[model samples]
Target: MPTGTPLAASRSTTERHDMTPSDPGARRAGADTTLVRHLNRRTVLTTLRSHPDITLSTLGSLTGLSRATLSAVLEELTERGLLEEHAPATGGSGRPARRYAFRATAGYVLGLHFTPNQVRAVVTDLEGQVVARERTEVPPSVPAPERLARARALAETATSQAGPVWSVGVATTGVVGPEGRVLRSSQIAGWTGLDLVGTVRGWYGRDAVAGNDGTLAALGEKWQGAARYADDVALILSGRPSGQGIVLGGRAHHGRSGAAAELGRLLQDQTWNAAAVLDEAGRTAQDVFRAASEGEEEASRLAAHLAHHTARAASVLVSVLDPQLVVIAGELTVGGRPFLEAVRLQLETMCINVPAVVLSELGDDAVPLGAARLALDALEEKEYALEG
Candidate 1:
């Protein structure tokens, strides 16, 4: 599991209220007791989610909620089936304090990712544990409509086995519009100007959310991969064509047009296209890496050349963004430590202040997990709105 501050921790703090006697009347006039109760409920629930199997007394100490208020909130949550209480061990003398925990199975969220060749879906419980997953491959020659349908079908199949999906998040390759449409995609055939979110919602019969695959991949790293400890990061996904995702102040930075970090576009050299580079050398990217591993001189030179170009591109981002860490993701990482060392070597020479560079631990699953993380955020928003 990723080891930074959990996403739920930052959101769990209660909003402070003034209790000065001079402003008592004004505060009372502006205050809604119902809103206060909801806030208290959210605080308690979020706290319990982070620290499971905690006694009520411990929760009271952590939240500073009076016993009366804490009891009321816990009771309400328990009644709503959002929390569960378990009895303590019998060895304790007379009576044991009961422990309360978040009911992870209370709801589910769906995460879907669509690429030129495949559609992947994952269903996660409220606590972000995978409950079910499905994947389907679509030939590159398939029409956009058919590809979209297959993706939707895969999502539906995953959701059906995972129970009620409270929220859905979709990640795809392209410049995603504010309204969740794919504005353009060079890799996917006839994918430009498609209403991706609308297609998912239309098929699933519920509102669904969407984001760029690169950005989501960065979020996934934060949530469960190599960048877990870094607040500011740049995730460079290397493949046929590379892409980048930026995280600043512990949040994904989607630029004004949601196309903030299109690193592949910055490269004017042929090295940017892995397929083209491999074709020229009469070897696949994987084959090149394998041969280089076996000490083949030609393959070693090719790997070094690709690393230099990648480092050149990455140095520009590092110089401008100054992120604490840079994560190399996608197909290039298949080369393993040798590829990472080569990139790091070039980066150290080019960069004035070189940040730590490492390979992505999540591989292809990063985007889908990041989408699930987004779905969890959406679920929290919906819950808050309902309570308010």
Candidate 2:
């Protein structure tokens, strides 16, 4: 588990509003009531966001809050214009029920995705809809300073058109620890042991959060792409160095050091040279898939080789943490049907349970949309938390 902000980094498994009388509960209750109230407001907001038309009565039941306590928090949030109450439902029962929902336009969020060859940015309203998007080629030899400058410039460009940037979320290809620290990376050359979050905050001076690219991609797929409503899942990104994000019990499992499910650096061959693989541009994993698709015999054999290695890697994942779905993204799987067909066949032969494998439906926007979800999820406004 992460350690920082109570809500984003570490919140108990149960909803925050529920007051449990346990050893941990004693410590929590002994703290400031204001903090608990704030958490309760956020809890209410998340609950309402998930069920848009939830009645006040249902809200209390879901969050395990008493009438008076729920009313107080609801009143505060509504007064702040973060939540809005709707007219009671009429014509169904003897007494109608009053419901509430998040005010979708209460604020704006910015999402940025940093790929090896490109940087994508998007601005979205509170509801996580992409209002604007831009992508730029990353410099060939992307030094850390240059990448930081590019991220800052791109974020400024995107936020310039939005009303106001409430929060910013950045996704990168690496082992990013909680509090936005990069533990390591096999793809981006100089990103290892870097303080990505601090650098971005220094550059933009905005409330920002950074995460592993695949984690954000999975979140985006759950929000606006494929895997919507999926619980146990993995997101596979096929780039120069592929990666996977693990989602268990409907949430990303950010491990103790924040590098729990990083699959890219899973060393398949100790002698495999990263530079040599990148030099043979035609030898990219995607190119191999394309060749096979075009009926080239060599391409077919190499594609099978790639599939076998990939399946073996996936088999490791299944043996440890079995997921329900695996979504393939990036140029490799963008071939859609054929790519999925071959990969699925290969994976089924290796795994214990045959997980549903599919190509990313979010197209090129998968990472950017994922950044958007991360941004919204980090909002101070409580209601945004409720989104499934």
Candidate 3:
């Protein structure tokens, strides 16, 4: 689990709302209180997320729940193994208080990221710690069905040795439509019009979800990377399909058709995807970036070409959204400041308002971690069924 302020250290999950306990003398006990009880449970669980070793008093304070109601919620959670109690600790002079923490190991989630050149899968606990991982390299010529089968096999194998998995999330290279359907994927042959969400669900026979890689990476960055504090952000991932994802007001901004950031077709001729350039040069992005940073002319020229196109698209997005920040992900991050400066310089000329552009700290893990975050959403928000 990440050691920082709860979830996004700089943000709060649920605001402290005044909540009153139910009347004990009600005639109908189980009829009316079921939904309320469930809500209270969710509140406690959400409050404890990434916030550990909290005493009852503090939990009550943060949640604004009455002591009696808070105690009942904690007892229910402890009974369900979602929380664990720690030994009593003496603090400032009152009686010792028993602390409780959310048990991240209560259940697990599977996340998979797929690009034209590679497939990566990870099984992470509820707190986003990778417990198992699998990867494979595939030529772009591989058929879509074959690639799907390989993805299924890798995902199944990755989760075999881990704890019980509650749900699965997939990040793929394409314009994802409603219900995880691939609206279009020109880079990978025969990949368009696939029912990705249903396909992944068949693999696990449980809850599954799918989304565009760049879009999910945006969510991942907000959850753990550079945009945690930014109210609005735009992210460009220079991987296969070279698309963008937008975050507005701390939530993903998927347009009506889930194609808000599908800029691959427009970018294909202008900006060569970073991996394709690196692969043809027979060099890694890191190697190219390092040489460019040292003032190598050839490397610097190639890096500038990539930066120019990235900035063009970013400039358009900045003009429209006027976001507070912009993030560069995937191979482009290795170029660091030189690449960013080039992009920023170009952006300044094209657009009057330019936000601060930075490299993604989550690196290759961004998509997968974001997929895990998606799976968690399935468990907590959508279906609201994590059984355990």
Candidate 4:
């Protein structure tokens, strides 16, 4: 899959008629239509989001729904303020069908990134476009509790700027346990066994979730950027100690203990910090990549070594997950073809039978966008929960 095609946009909405219709004594087609309505509405919205300005007939064809059913779905979505209709098409020889689009203000999501050096926040509308963003440096030595406090404060501030945010999501490094505890992450200071979701809930009094940075980046990319059409994607995040986020069947696979894909620590020898070697003198991942670009032989060598290790790790994951595509992002990919080509070469050599690999499209904002998507999803879940 190319990095530009979004997965949600390419989703097939054709109804499956595998189950034969029951007798009139059974549940009515009204019930089935209700399910179909919900499903088709989502499909319509997803399609409009990707295409931005599209016709209703086109939507009907894409969703494989009858024009009547598409009309009903669009009406329901529009009534709920989730979508909007534009003027009927004109000027062409034939009559123009009215176009439909997802309303940018239908809902809001908050994406927050807590890095060791900075706290980055973004607010996105339903279409995943950034509406508000803030980035500020923090003391890397701050205690975990203090850092969380600061992060929460920044989140609230960003939310205020975005106005009427529906939910909040956090992305960080380390292990986000199934129990919602962050265990043994080296991306941020004092972030071990931290109850991230609980902390956000307590602080903001709203729905929230936390995930590993690499995982979140992969999610964001899969949702709106590159690798969108892929059912299985491996995001190899190279920087200080490389890591990976694996998406299988459209959802991130965090594993049993939330430590599923830690690509950084996949070492040939147990005595090395892959991140440290890449970021000599304890520089940020960006600095190391920059050094390599400046023709620093050591930096170039370290970058190559990192790519080699990353490919080896990816091979291990491919052997198990058999991902459809691999996305190489973070500081290293910005090294342009040098880093991406090297990594691809290594992956070909390491896992000759694996899936295609590509560079990320969202750049450094992938994780933050993933966080925002998480926040929106949480908000929707809460709405359903309340209704139930």
Candidate 5:
């Protein structure tokens, strides 16, 4: 598995198919050529996305398509600028075969992570590279209109810098519906029912998808950060407004109403005041972490307080899911080694079987990066419907 390979399934599926008449979905009598051509287009596109350096003979052998079919599909894709044909290497004994590569920068996507405390935006190419980014802090008491205004500005600025975006992805607090609707949000004050999809869709005039911050952050970690190899993972998002992200069998679990990983409510009434713990003594979580890192006893105590509160919530999730790994992400990561150690200690005491506790390699940027992954998925056939 390369650092940014498309995914394991993409490669495995191609290996089993040899696109001949015997294939299950192969065209038959009275079949539509337009539909078949579109199907072929999608198949070639997906194969190259995962195996960009494939040669003609290898592609033919893997796809089970004849040379003439591949040539036609390749020509159509090349004309659209989604693929490129490289000059064949001269080292081979016979006539060298040309290589094919996916044009990762052919288009860009905008990924936004909006919360009551801050708004972050990023522009990623087709290959999930962050070419541009913008982030701003917001007061906890700010009204929804003010919060949205600030986020919209950041989105516009980042999009312009990264060129035209093909689609949009939004990450926010609360129970988000598939259409980008905010069904419920206690953290955002008055931001519920804002219809994020419609608003952001209008902003970029492009297709968009929205999801819970915790869920997306979890996905961001699985896709590009820690938990890449773990089949099941629990991500504890520690900050002023803490949440959770769950991954089961290598996919994000959103529950019945997108509240699967929202453990904030359970801890709010009993365990600890997350706001009081993360923001205290007029110091931000980052400042407290720096002070603790410098050996300040008071700051160290506060860091433990945060870990204790987070670990309690984590213990509950671990008992049920019993994931292979537990990841700590968000501003809490600024606390460094000591903070994570404290969380692991708490978990060890509470649960008979504690998973490996690790810090999110993507850190605070995890949410936005995951949002980019959402937009990238929309470009694939699985996420969209073909039109005649």
Candidate 6:
């Protein structure tokens, strides 16, 4: 069968039967068949992506599909260049059965992080493996149009050798609406009212997605970082401006107006703004943590002060959402156990119930990685719609 041709089960049964053309039952059966085929194809693709190089027999067992159905699906995928068949490498086998793997290199996706000081881009394949990355420094004094142009150039450079890009995702520091508009951003001057999605789509000639950096960081952790196993998570992203992202029931919760967990905006009577505090000391959050790690009393004092504010912010989230895991992400967490332990201790004291608080494993790449994931998801949705 041709790659794009519908499977027998997905075709109209009325065409195969001698029933009248106006038979309602036959039409419903055909529609049901098409829906079932679409679902089965999605299931097979999902399973193959999760378990690459799986034997056909193993795939059938994992997907619970009969041999005939599995064979048809595999043939179609292979014909479409989305799946590759290979002989199993076993020394004792009489005849190695063919194994199948998703073709990760078939297409690529672009992810970008646009900030006041820097623009970073990453190219990933269908399997979410990083293919290429580029970073460009953008001085704060640069005009908004110039900064955006530079960001676009960086994205183009990053994906130059990655082949065809299926989708694009951009992560920015601000309140990003569902339609990809930057509603508000204090870090980047004149950033509000920017059509982030439109700009990115123009650059790549494909539909794009945009999201808040902190929210994407939470998704990054849930996708492949520290919070992978947690169903409900709150991510505290510490940087020049700290922010928070909440994930409940395995999805990022972007509240009304897409500003749900703006932890930096949370009111506190006596809060320690880590960025402001460190700036007053002529140091960065990383510098304070480094000094504390080296046993500097003054540095430890500053770290503790910052921890107090972080814990206080977390306590509010814990009290309200009661997440299963609280993740401390970004450059500050690079201080390792000292920073995490300090924050953990402070949270234990403030919260009525302390959840498992830990540090993010993805570090600086979290936002970009999460953006790539969003692009991948968009591609999957498009494919599913076409199939359906």
Roughly what TM-score does model 6 have, to 2 decimal places? Answer: 0.87
Task: List, residue by residue over 1-388, the lDDT tens digit for candidate 6.
Answer: 2332212213322253755547988667666766777777888999998998998889999999999999987776776667888777788659887888988877788889876788888888888888898999887678788998898888878888787777898898889999999999878867899999998899867879988887888887888899999989998887554778888887777788888887655655434566677777888877888888899999989888888887777787888998999999875786688778889999988888899999999877788888888887777776665333
Runs of candidate 5 with Cα error greater than 4 angstroms are 1-39, 91-96, 140-143, 286-297, 381-388
Better of 2 and 5 by TM-score: 5
* Deviating ranges (above 4 Å) for candidate 4: 1-80, 84-101, 186-190, 263-272, 279-300, 379-388
lDDT of 3 by residue, 226-264 (tens): 888897889998745477888888877778888887765
lDDT values of the candidates?
0.79, 0.70, 0.78, 0.72, 0.79, 0.80
Better of 3 and 4 by lDDT: 3
RMSD after Cα superposition, model 2: 7.1
For candidate 2, give the lDDT of residue 289: 66
Better of 2 and 3 by lDDT: 3
User: Residue 287, candidate 1: how far off, in angstroms?
Assistant: 0.8
**Cα miss at 251, model 5 (Å)?**
2.4
Cα lDDT over the full model 6: 0.80
lDDT of 6 at 13: 27
Question: What is candidate 4's local distance difference test score?
Answer: 0.72
Which candidate has the top score in lDDT? 6
How many collisions between residues are there in candidate 4? 7
Candidate 1 local lDDT, 349-377, one digit each (tens): 99899999999998878889888887787
TM-score between candidate 2 and the true structure: 0.75
Say which prediction, candidate 1 or candidate 3, comes out ahead on TM-score.
Answer: 1
Give one digit per residue, the lDDT tens place, for model 2 in 66-177: 9998988776665555677789988896788888897766567778888777788988877776778877888647887788778778878887776556677888888788
Question: Cα-based RMSD of the predictions, in order?
Answer: 6.0, 7.1, 7.1, 7.7, 6.5, 3.9
Better of 3 and 4 by TM-score: 3
Separately for all candidates shown, the number of backbone clashes (residues 3 or more apart, or on different chains) is: 0, 2, 0, 7, 0, 0
